[model samples]
Target: MAGGTVLVVGGGLAGITAALGLADAGRSVTLVEARPRLGGLTHSFRRSSRAGDLWVDNGQHVFLRCCTSYRRLLDRLGVSDLVSLQPRMDIPVRSGASPRVARLRRSALPAPLHLAGALAAYRWLPPAARVSAARAALALGSVDPDDPAVDEESFGRWLARRGQGPRAVEALWDLVGVATLNAPAERASLALAATVFQLGLLESNDAGDIGWVRVPLQRLHGDAAARALAAAGVRVELRTRVGRLPTTYDDVVVATGPAVSEDLLPGDALDLAPGWSARLGSSPIVNVHVVLDSAVLDEPFVAAVDSPLQWVFDRTAGSGLDPATGQYLALSLSAAEELLGRSVAELREWTLPELGRLLPRSRSARVLDFFVTREPQATFRAAPGSRKWRPATATRLPGLHLAGAWTDTGWPATMEGAVRSGEAAVASVLGRRTERTALGATA
Candidate 1:
């Protein structure tokens, strides 16, 4: 654990964090990644164009200010300046083209009281629903995420029992739940939802303040992490696939996706259950990127209600789009199983009009180009009983361990969970106690 080589398979945030943690602890680390770059799911690409090539992220990843571990990772990589956190929690939420943009803002008050004004004034929900939302939020703060019964029920069912109806679920619950849990409230586990809501919104005043990278995710995660780890004397291997566990290292961390980890992990080496990985089913996410002739959206980010647009981010600067020519916007659709098979042309036809509806400036602006990015198995489905499938960092095989967002970190499949799992894996390898870092949630 002190000096022997520790092999970390997968170049994701989880793998990167583990490698860095190990190397910092005076242990020789080798990070093997199947992809050419470091970032696994969170990456960027170059979009060819007649004018010039543009840098675009594969998916939009948003984090909260309370994500201390991820923030520490950023600091370690020396890319902390590449991202910015909002001054406070202010979400521009639109419900169709109602001309009324509901602002979900938080005050500087203590927990639970910080959001009372925002919730009371939320225009999307009726007055009665807003009252019920307060009650429900308070109730969520009391629910324990570790209880087996909590994971067995859907957040929607719990909210319904607390007087939340369809309108409230759509305007309030789904608005936040679907984006975080990657599923609707009706399908997401109450345990995960409770963790998201309690830690993110109810526990602290600044926990929900949003932060996002100003540059491409590749630069922020993959390239920066690679540079950081290599400088620490860590052996970095890219575009390398380990079909079987290599016996060269003292310890190996299987940090790949859930299904891929199950595949790469030797059957006879560990005493894991045969159906363990299978139980953590996957959920899909679809991202629609559009370049328009004008800056339709003024805000950096926005959330939608009663619209196909779940969340939209203006990536004009990040995408290297010439402000004088056109603007670029990326729309993230979580739990996007229905839209996975849709063609880009079909998606463009509908999404453009929806954008125009939300932003009147887009009504007359011409669409320069449109494209879609799909992740069929983006994250393990955080539905009912998912906690039972999530394994701990330690495995039966002392030489091999696990690390990924799918593992139990008391959070959903987000950047925070990925980093937390990595640290946990490192702690397991070092035979040290794991210290829980501060962070609210991730995308």
Candidate 2:
């Protein structure tokens, strides 16, 4: 087990974490990735505009204070200062159906009770529905996310059974579920929804405090990782595609997407049935970037209800846009099944008018630039019965493991899940090596 050679495929957060951990443990690790960059899904690109070269992220990704593993990865990469976390959780919610803007800010109280005041005063929901929502939240806190029965039911049906009507689901449940789960309550599993609520809201008061990157994702993740990997003595091979699993390495960690992992692993490596990756499915996310001549959104970000706009974030600082000249905003559209097929021109037409209704200042602002970025396979679809498709880190074949957000980490497909999968894979690899060494010594 000492100084064993390990190969990590896919240079995303999972692969990067595995490589760094293995190298630090005195293992010779080689990280390979097909893409030219390292931060797989979370990346950025430069776009030419009249204002100047604008840095645009593929998608707007945010993490919570509860995501310790992901934050540790950021610290390890030496880019912890490049991101900012909220002093406390506060979200400015705007509904196109109503002119009033609601706030979902938490107070300095304990779990469950911290959100009581916010829920009681939520302008989107009726007084009766808010009370019902609070009761449902408490009921959900008790649901075991690891239970097989919980995975069999939809969150929406569970809410309805607990007296949560359409208004509660739309105004309260969907507000959080759609952004985090990447699926509506009706399509999302009760198990996954319970996990998000319990860990983020019910379990602790500060767990749901949001954090986002202030710099381009590329600089924060990929660039920093490259420097860290080099210092760790891990060999990094970018733009290298491994058609078959290499036999030379003592251990191999397949950290690619489900489809890619399935193709690379041995037929009998995993215990799951055939076509499990396909059954796992995927969800899409579309990001619309808009540059205006004048500042429209005053806050850092805002969530929308009863409108096509899901979440709008001020990207001026991150994109290096001159604030004096204009403003840059990014609209993050999750579970974007309907908008995926729409043309760029069609999106601009529909989005501009909607912005006028949601943010009145946008109506008079001159349009400088408008573009869209789409990820068809953004994340694994977290629908009912999805846990069966996500396998454990250890494989049937010895010395082989899987690392990705799609794996069974008891969490949804998120950055935290991805980092946890990598850590688990490393643990499995080292644990097996120790077992083999013990057997040899006894012999």
Candidate 3:
């Protein structure tokens, strides 16, 4: 994996990061993708409109300020402004709620106090629920990172122990779950939840600041990544799905989907007990794309706490959709297990009513068109006792390094985690000169 040439299989951020890092280090790198695009889930496409042209993303994706590696990736792409960063954490939880907002602002005070205003002002939770949520946060803040039991219990169990009922869990922890594991907190491991929340929310001020691309996902991720990698002398091939890895190619890297990697591994990967071992199950993310005649959601994004929609992102400006003409809304329904195998028509019938209820403007608005996209293996099931299932960056095979959101990057299965995992693969593949060469923009 060190000297001659390295083949990176996958065109996602993982592969792009690895290819850029490796090629910049003077290694011959070839990146291959089964799809015509490289951004994977974050890719975008165009839609025709009466006013003009419209661009929309495949899914609604967001990152926190804590995602430094991802931030660096954007900076290196020279499109840092292409994504909008919230100065603080401003989550409009529910429109029906009295205050209808929650802002997790970073303060001049210490880290704990920085969160006090947010917790104290969280109007979504009842007064008792708010106090209980504070205690829960304290409990999570104090958990030892190295504790074995931390990885064994579900976050729901921990919250239940701390007196969080279903109502509170929905208002509080489920949102955390959607942002972290992309699964319900009740079904996710306490360790992963604590890791995500403590690091992203409680431990650091400015940690929960939100960032979403202000362009089509493909433009922001795949197209831009391809240009950057090509500039670094990496050959990127799309629409070349790799079914298996060549065993003889010792310096190869597998940045493909986890299922693809599991299908290609030559060694006793299961016997070695990778972190992905425990998280064998998959979760579904169903993003219902709604094309509105006019802008329905004025906010850039909103988290639907009381509705069937987990989160909604207004990609009108960024998706290339003319705000004056049409709007594109990406509805992300996480842990959509039951809805995975359904048809787009079925989803529309089921979803539109709920969305319209949450956003009164949509009541009389005729949906120009609607579609549904599903990711069956969107994320590895981060249930209790599931941490060990994540694979390592350095695999059993020398050339076959691994990169995915599911990798043991200590971060949740997020864009940040994906970037962190890619960075790890990059650092590993560059070898000696990595410190001097590949680490240029990344470090």
Best by lDDT: 2
Whose lDDT is higher: candidate 2's or candidate 3's? 2
Give lDDT tens digits, candidate 1, residues 49-81.
Answer: 642578989999999987888899899999999
Find the candidate with the highest TM-score and give its number.
2
Q: Over the stretch 1-443, how does candidate 3's per-residue lDDT look in tens digits? A: 34567788888877777777777667888888899888876787777655456676767788888889989888877779788898877777764433255654556566767777777787777888888888888888987655668888888888899999998888778876765687787788888888888878887778888888877788888888878988887887777866656543326777776666776665454345443433466777888888888877878888866777778888777766666766778888888898888888788888888887777778687787687777788877877776666777875434457888878787777888888888899776655222212211100
The digit string of per-residue lDDT tens for model 2 on 1-443 reads 45788889999999999999998898999999999999999999999897678999999999999999999999999999999999899989998776679999999999989999999999998898888889999999999998999998999999999999887888778888998899999999999999999999899999999999899999999999999999999999999998877667788899999999988877777888879999999999999999999998889899998887989999999999999989999999999999999999999999999988888889999999999999999999999999999989998877888999999999898899899999998898888863221111100
- Looking at candidate 3, the ten consecutive residues that score lowest on lDDT are 434-443
TM-score each candidate. 0.96, 0.97, 0.90
TM-score of 2: 0.97
Candidate 1 TM-score to native:
0.96
On the 0 to 100 scale, the lDDT of residue 103 in model 1 is: 97
Prediction-by-prediction clash tally:
2, 0, 15
